[model samples]
Every structure is written in structure tokens, then in C-alpha cells.
Target chain A: MADAPETFEEFRKSFSYGERSDLDFKFMKSLSDDEAAQFLAGLLAHVGDAYDHARLTDIIDYVIDWQARAYAPAPDAKRTWVYEEGPFATPAKPLADSRVALLTSSGHFVHDDDPEPFGVVGMTQQEAEERISEFLKVPPELSRVPVSFAPGELRVRHGGYDVTSAALDHNVAFPLDHLHDLQADGVIGELHDEAFSFMGAAAQMRLQKETAPEWAKMLRDAEVDVVLLVPV
Target chain B: MCHVSVGHVGRAIEEAGIATTAVYVRAFGHVVDEMKLPRVLITNHPMGRPLGPVGDRQRQRAVVASALSLIDSATEPTVVDDLGPFRPVGG
Candidate 1:
């Protein structure tokens, strides 16, 4: 490969489309003056070696994608909602009453609360479990126990803004895997069919558009009626 | 870490005109103040998994219900009351 890409297209098409860390330098050039400056600073700080410039470029590209997603025009028609997992007694039943939920990823959560230190909530294990139990309304015996939770933090300068972001202390717990288990076992009245995991804070518009079609299709496929988002 | 892409996706879906409800676990206070999105649920949970820890179905259901309720209740951007910190049985 040449030391520097001559065109934006050449730079954008250089990396694999899906790798989160790959930097599309061409995309960086296309950024508005503000975005471009942020991209360059992030590149210099994260990409210490010339060889790693491509990776740095990918991160920048991801940021650009975030900008696009953030500013995209709102759609006019009612779109379908999808969930990843939940309880549905009948697979063929209509989802008119069903709701879609969103779960946030640790990284994006941090960005949402930029400048705040990670795990500032200082939630204790007892507090975490109690909150989980209350949120789900599950008996102590049926609830999945959390084993571990940790925080991840990052700092980046973008668009004349300095961002110091940190993920909440992430907790890893056993899966309450079966939706039916809740209802069949008398845990709740209905199973929602699916739940969601969110990392929206990390998403760029370009990438979201590329990925949204699948989620939209999932809602269509499952015939979901409502979407419920729970931010991490 | 909870990736930023997730929020964008939700926004994208919302922009697509779907009646969407976003439950922000930790940044509820910030989202309500900053973005001006509709039907938001606020909690002080971590990222990646929003409905509280992973496998607690009851909490998940409540969170879902809270978010769903927002569909009809949110006339403008609104934030549901906080569920506060998690506590184990009778703690």
C-alpha cells in the first residue's frame, strides 16, 4: 500500500467494513472542518505508529458515523420494533401489545455522561442485586445473580470538544434465559419475546443505517408492536 | 463498554417514525436535559445491558413496562421516575 492514500474513496474502501477499530482515512478527509480536526487529534494520540494509522482511521470513521446518526433527519412513517429475546406463548401470535427495548453498551453509556468518572454511582453488590430484582420483579430464587461488573473509560477530543468518557461498572450475571420461565412458572403475566442490548453511543450514522435494516426486519419478522429501550 | 452505536441506532429507529421508547439506565438525568428525545426511562445502571443486570426477568419486565407506558403518556419529551438503586430481597 502507498504511504498515504491519494483519494477519499481509496482511503474509505481500504479497510474491512465491519471492524470497529479500522480507520477509514478517506472518510476522515470528508468530515466537516470541525469533525476533521477532532479526527486528526484522535488519530495522532491513538495512532502512535504510522502502521497503525489505518486502525486509528477506523475509529475516526466510527466517530463520523456517530455524527451522522446524531444529526440524521427523523423519519415520517411508523417503523417496526424488534427485541432480541423475550417470552411469547405463541410464536404466531400478533405483537400488537408487545414493546421493543434498548440496552446500552458500556462504552456508549460513558459517552452519554462524558466528563464523569466511571462507577461514580458507587453501587454496592447488594444494591445492584436489589435493583435488578426490583426492575424485573423476580423472586430472589429466580433472579440471575451478578458475578462481576467493571468499568471502561476513554478520552477523546472531537469538534472543539474535549470528551472524557467512562462506562458504568459493567456487571456480568447469569442469564434469566427463558421468558417462559417467568410466566409458566408464574413469574409474570406475559413474556415480551425479546430484550435488547444497546451500544448506540458508539454508533455512527452510516453504520447505524447499514445495521438498522436487520433490526427493522427483525421487528417485521416477529411482528412486534412496541419497543422498550433500557439504557445501560 | 457500551458502544455509542447503540444510541445512534435507537435514534435512527426513532427517526424512522417508529413509536420508540428509550430507557437510559445511568444517564437518565443527562439525556432528559440534553437530547430532548421522547419517552425516556431513567435508571442508574451500567452500559451494554439496560434492563438491569442480565438475567433478572422481573426487573426486565418492569423496565419494559415502564418504557411501553411512555408510548401513550409522553406528550412531549418526558422522563419516568427513577427506580433508584438496586436492592436484593428486603435489603
Candidate 2:
């Protein structure tokens, strides 16, 4: 285990620019404040529309039962936080000059993107449960689509969290429009032709192992310089 | 961006040689720091609504601006630009 750093500055220097075997399952309540000179905890000012206690109250109990089993890891193994000898990349140019790609892990897909039973709304309860079980059982995979894909065709199928805001406007999570605005205003130079979405949270261990590299390949394929990640 | 947990993916992309940034729930700010994610702009809007609230163009645009700007400015591990304290407007 790595010794903890007392301050942000110390924390930055202590970690030998590498990864270590440490668990990341800290709880989510009571984040700190941005009130004075110091940085705040999770920095959440207010919960958005679709979120409430009903959804989050069971997180500790549920994720242990849900995503923990999704990848079929050995007991006592840390499934989510994969360590790496990271060489963190930096932006080469100003935002207005970089080709940007956006990825959202909000379980979003256009209606036509679903092949068969995956998005069939009227399936029998047994069928739905079985399909969800299968979906969760497999390793993580990403759904890629053209940024030009119609927003009206977008729909969210994730059961992990409230999708109300995303259901209202995909921009809440997959802000392709906002990105376009950025492009228009010269905040970012170019928007990649494609955008990607993963089905759920990054806690789905399979994502870190398989799907991420695939997404990285796509970003590389597009000559993307800056990528933006937004969560739901 | 969508799930607060996706910061790891941002770090992966950064590792892949593309600089990255994210906007997520403020509650996970410390987690983002510990994971040493690239440029992140965190907001206090509810969990799923990381880009401000639903249908609020100004807030969403502002949030996106802050996130993108991290590319131009951030030079350290897991340094954050907190957009918390800003209220999302709608349901």
C-alpha cells in the first residue's frame, strides 16, 4: 500500500508517477466544501432532476451484488480499479485547434442501434430479466455512432441510475449539441465524426480491460487530440 | 461525464496519448483526484446531470466550456475546476 499524502501537493509527488494496488471503494456521502481556499469533496452543489435518495440509498448494497458479479471476479479481488504504469498525455494545441471526441457512459443508444431483443420494449418480464442478465453478464462493450446521428432517435436504456434528465435532452449526458456549440464558437477546433457511449458506469470492470482500448483505437483512428468524458 | 466513475476511462484515453477532460458529480471529486485523472471539471448538479440540469443551454454551455478549457490550462495530476455551487435550473 502507498502511504497517504497530507496535502494535494504532497499527494502529487508521493505517487512515483505510477499505479499501485489500492482499492477505491470509498463512500459517496459528505464530500468536502469549496468554501475557503481548499478544494471541496465531490463538489456537488445540487442533485439533478432524476436523482434522489431512493436511487442511491442502496448503492453500497446493490453495486456489491450487481457490478461486482457482472464480471465474475475471484473473491477479494478488486475488479474496478485496474492499476497501470501510466504516462498521462497532455493536449498538444489549444482547444480550438484540436479534434475533439466525446464519449458518454449513460447507457444511451439510438432506437435503430438495437439489433433485436435488446431494446424491445414489450418483451415479457421473464425475457426482459433474462436479457438484462445476459447484458450484465458479458464483458463490457461500447456502442459507437455518428455524432450526426439524430438526437430524436436517441434513447436511454440504463437501469443503473435515473435517466430523467437524459430522457429530457441527451445533452444532459451526451452533449453533442453543446459540443457543436463549442465548435461553432471556436472553443474547440473540430468535433470528431463519431461519438461513443458505454452501457453503464466505468465500474463495470470489463470496460477498463476491453472496451476502453477499443474506444482508444477509435479515437486514434479519428486523429482525435482531445477527448471529453461525461457521466450520467 | 455521464457516470462519475468514467474518470478512469478519461485517464485511459490520456494514457493512450490523447489529452482528456471530464465533467462529473462533485461527490466524486476526491476520487478523481486519487485516481489522478487528467483535466476534470466537476459540478454539483445531481449525479446523472453532470452538465448542469436538463435543457438549460446557458449552464450546459458554460459547463462544457469549463471542461474543455482544462485542456488549455491544467498541467498536473487530478487538478479540478469545480463548477459546483452552481444550481442546475430544471427537471
Candidate 3:
């Protein structure tokens, strides 16, 4: 484990790094800022003795269950909770000699390429959140961006998390800039001419069954040897 | 959900014969296990900033480097390297 956090501020930062779910978001929404602080304080009190990964996991599990029981209108159940099996592939060649491509779920689109990509372009944040489930039912739209695409022309639209940081610097989610830099430094052999983006906080059935296979074929046709997936 | 969706996408791409490594915020590794992605590098950054905080190129490069290491070294299904919480300097 990393060094145990010392103060509440430190604890908060540490906790933020942990994984979160819809339940956690709703549970947090239910808590006032003061209550949230108190909860953090309660957790902070146990930092040293019983704060290992397993124990923290147990606590989180307990809180999730408690939230389900305690809240009047429980957090909306995730409609698509299916976990289908997936296939794997081993690298045919070393990274130093293989062509690489990037695929991200950061909801980025070219500025003028698609005016209303994902159908949530002009909607307010409130509207997008209200209808995100509906949006997920649509087939995943792959936004094919050339590696040479200008970073200044990228625009982000995603309802699952705060887009402020991504809007400011897409490298937070896309990382194409760094990938290009790595390519220039010969960390990898070559960057594929195209990078891919799509909204990932979706039901995923269509993505898995229909769209993803198409994406795979495209990458294969392009002779990409490796793909780096960055999920926001 | 992003982790799960991205895992699915990675799976399809890999199944097509190209190797893949998913870099995602650490949430629901068990689900990733169920999906059986070939390799994953889980970071403790927030959901939106999976690479790291915005504008931190050094930190983002560290994440990509970690992912590359996972890709180069993984020998089985679901190889994971959890690089714990990367705090930006003086944040």
C-alpha cells in the first residue's frame, strides 16, 4: 500500500483516487458537505490499524449495501450489468517494431466534422444526464480522428463524469499528444494514422455486438499491431 | 461503465488479432476479470482524467509508460498493474 495518508486533506485526496461507482455518486449526493466530511473523518480515524486494501474494500462494500437499504429511492439500478466473456490476443511482435493505435472513450469529436455527434452535443448537462440511458441504446458511433488532427479542434461531450478537465486538456483522457511524442522518441515503431473515440458510459450491448467488431476490422485492415485503450 | 465498455472494445480489437492494453481508472477489476481483457493498467486517477490530471504531460506519460510495460510483460489473461494514486506536485 502507499504510505498512509496523514491529514483529512491528504485522506480526501487519497480516497479520491479509489474507484467509484454510481452508488458512490448517489450516496455522495445524498450527503451534505458537512456530512461527507464527517464520513471522511470517520474513515480517516482508521487509517493505520484497519485500512489495508481488503479492509477498505469491505468497508466500501458495506457502505454500498447500506446505501441501497437506507435510501428511500435507491440509486437507479444499472440496466446493463451483463458481463460477457471477451477474447484476448498476444503481441506478435515487440513494441519497438510494432505499429500502435489509440482508442478512447472520452467522447471527443472533430469540431466541424460532426455537428451533433452522440446526439448530446447541444443539450445542457442536465438534459444529457437525464437521457444518457436512452443515448446508450444507440449504436456506438466511432469518431475516426487522424493522428495529425489538431488538439485545438477537439471537443468533448460525455455525461458520465466532469468534462471540465477534459475540455481544458484532452490529454487527460485522450493522451494522443503523448502517444505522438512517444512515437517521435521511438518508444513504439509508428503511430497509426487514425485514433478512435466514442462515448463509453453506455449500455455496451451494441458496442460489443455490432460496433466494436467493425472497429476491430478497421484496425486490422490498417495493420495496427497494438492498440492502447484509454477509458474516461 | 467506461472500464467495462472499454474492456469490451479492447476484447473485440484483440480478438481480431491485434494485441490491446486498456488503461482505465481502477474500478470493478472483477468485472474486467469477467471480461477477460488481455492486459490492463489501472490507475487511481479520477474517472475523467484516466491518464492523470489535465495539463500534466509528465504524469500522463508515466501512465502510458505503465501501460506499455504491461503490454510488453503480460503473459496471460488479465495482467494488471495498479500504479497507486499519482498526486500532482504540490497539489
Candidate with best DockQ: 3
**Candidate with more favorable, higher TM-score: 1 or 2:** 2
Interface RMSD of candidate 2?
A: 6.6
- Per-residue lDDT value at A205 in model 1: 41
Query: Arrange candidates by TM-score, highest first: which order?
Result: 3, 2, 1
Off by over 4 Å in 2: A1-86, A115-136, A201-203, B1-5, B86-91
The sequence of per-residue lDDT tens digits that candidate 3 reaches over residues A16-89 is: 22233232344354444565676656556555435454355434433433333322232464435444555668
Predicted complex 1: DockQ: 0.15
The docking category that best describes candidate 2 is acceptable
Question: What lDDT does each candidate get?
Answer: 0.39, 0.62, 0.70
Question: Which residue pairs show backbone clashes in model 3?
Answer: none
Weakest lDDT window of 10 consecutive positions for candidate 3 chain A: A15-24
What's model 3's overall lDDT? 0.70
DockQ of every candidate: 0.15, 0.37, 0.50
- Relative to the real complex, the DockQ score for model 3 comes to 0.50
Q: Ten consecutive residues with minimal summed lDDT in candidate 1 chain A?
A: A138-147
In order of appearance, the predictions have TM-scores of 0.39, 0.68, 0.75
Q: What is candidate 1's lDDT per residue for A106-174, written digit by digit as tens?
A: 222222333222233433323332232232221111111111212233212111111112222122211
